[model samples]
Target: MSSRQRRNDSAPQYLDATTLTAWRNVRDAGEVVVSRISAEMENQSGLSLDWYGILLHIYEGGEDGRLPQRELERHLYLSQSGISRMVSKMQEAGLLRREPSPHDRRNVYVVLTDLGRDVFLRATPVHHAAVQRHFGSWLSDDEIASIGRGLQKVLTAEGGSEIQCGEELDRLVTFGQSVLALTSDTVAVSDAILVRDALEPLLLADAARHVTPSAVQDMRAIVARMSTLIDSPEEFFRSDWELHRLLAGYCHNELLRSMYLTLLGTLSSRLDSVVPTTNLTPYLYERLSVHARLVEAVSSGDEDQVAEAAHAHHFTMARTRLVDAPGE
Candidate 1:
């Protein structure tokens, strides 16, 4: 049987159409193309095309890797709260975050976390491969190109243009190289301050206010794990990121998420270069204690309390970092 026949062979005997000659029939036949490929992708990889589409839109839609929730709602035709809730779920999975609009506070923007971006980068290839397996293998490149051009003409009427994920990756790689070139001058403390400021007030405050009960439980579980692993700083830090990454999802602001993540990348890279693991070992208990409190504050659904706790932690951490240590 042909690939198309094999893909959807459950047709009843009365629905006996071996070939699709009409334009409407052909269009209808292609309607399930995305669903078929997405199914294949899910079977092979855990990522679903729906999730991939959201990430793709954000990656392609925004200049600074941020896209408004409103635009997503339009593109996907989701209800305001529908998009809000879906992004919240992805946020819980540590794949996305929310932030208020820089231009309009009433609007929310969706952005990918570092982990979210990484997952997207990995899943896109699996998606392309799945497409080839399910459909591309049957069509020649020329045929595919012809279909693309033909479809573009129709898409043009709707003001849609093609955006390649590969192109976006290339741009990111180039930008990353430029940033890496200046790592010598990047200051960890300064970057940390900028990130902390953005996160503690607007981004995290939003998250705390919108946090669901299940989210709070998940975060507390991560914190509980941290307490057990405090002596094991390596494992503790992993859980640390898990808790914060989960918290990032609650904000529902794309712009804030982007800004916070950018500064954090710089802060993390610089801190890794400047701080030794041995030096960090002495402070794991304090780190765990502070994080436990931070999670509880968020779980309380009190944005003010979260901000206060976060502020106190930062200052406390800074003081510890600044104090001179006697020779070990």
Candidate 2:
């Protein structure tokens, strides 16, 4: 090949040194700010960062300062059981209370008590101060504007919008439950099967869309990273979530993508809980192969082929988790 032809055929390098440095700086700065703020929040208010976040979300959640239990779970970086326990503890402390949904007996809502509101009001200043000290202080006004513009561009590209209400909201809640069932070990096999069945069609539809080349490349990189982490279950699980996030990004439906992002916290918590004890090597390899097929199907833009690949992927995942469960 001619030298120019060889260069044209090579993969494009998206991240130059300056871009890499900026990305690392943002990541490190975020970690530092979070650490400082968490320590201050705990020391001054006796509230862990997670507790404070839950309280804050509850306070802003709705007109009545109440959020449904499942919605609350979405806002929280906790598993279903972990959030339940946290709610119980907060209730015992007179911070919050849970009420059964008036319309649906099976549903529960979390309401911030007067005391919870007061606590949140008190903690807001401390949180702001930490952010100012560790994060805001370091950035110039121009830099802040640039960062906001950059983030807005990202959000726009990702189909970001305010969470929709009504029927879409209901569907989102159901999606969250399905995700919990798929990730949590405590869910009954019957329930898991039901969740998988419900999710399969959605995944197939998402797979049928023609995703941007950047997304395809992102999945490829995630799969490569997963291969390197096969022996490190925790890291592998983290990479697994990244892969799902990329796949979810391919959904052409804005509401579906938004809902998927909302449930990521719960998904992360559930995956974290299961990774340590589960035999993950077999599952990892299976996932890598399935994802490879999925990428190919997506690239071809064949709806039937995409659906077939998605079905096989979900079946393999369910079998890996249910049939080959830890200690079984």
Pick the TM-score winner: 1
Locate the minimum summed-lDDT window of 10 residues in model 1: 172-181
lDDT (C-alpha) at residue 185 in model 2: 33
Assess every candidate by TM-score: 0.43, 0.42
What is the lDDT for 263 in model 1?
A: 60
Candidate 1 overall lDDT versus native: 0.63
Candidate 2 lDDT score at position 252: 74
The C-alpha RMSD in Å for every predicted model, in order, reads 20.8, 23.9
List the lowest-lDDT window of 10 residues for candidate 2. Answer: 168-177
> How many clashing residue pairs are found in candidate 2?
0
Model 2 local distance difference test score: 0.62
- Per-residue lDDT tens digits of candidate 2, residues 202-314? 85477457587777787788878877886775576678667767777677777766655555544455442221222235656676677778777776778888887777666
- Compose the digit string of candidate 1's lDDT tens values, residues 38-122: 7766664466677778888887776687898888987776688887877887787777888888899889889888756666654
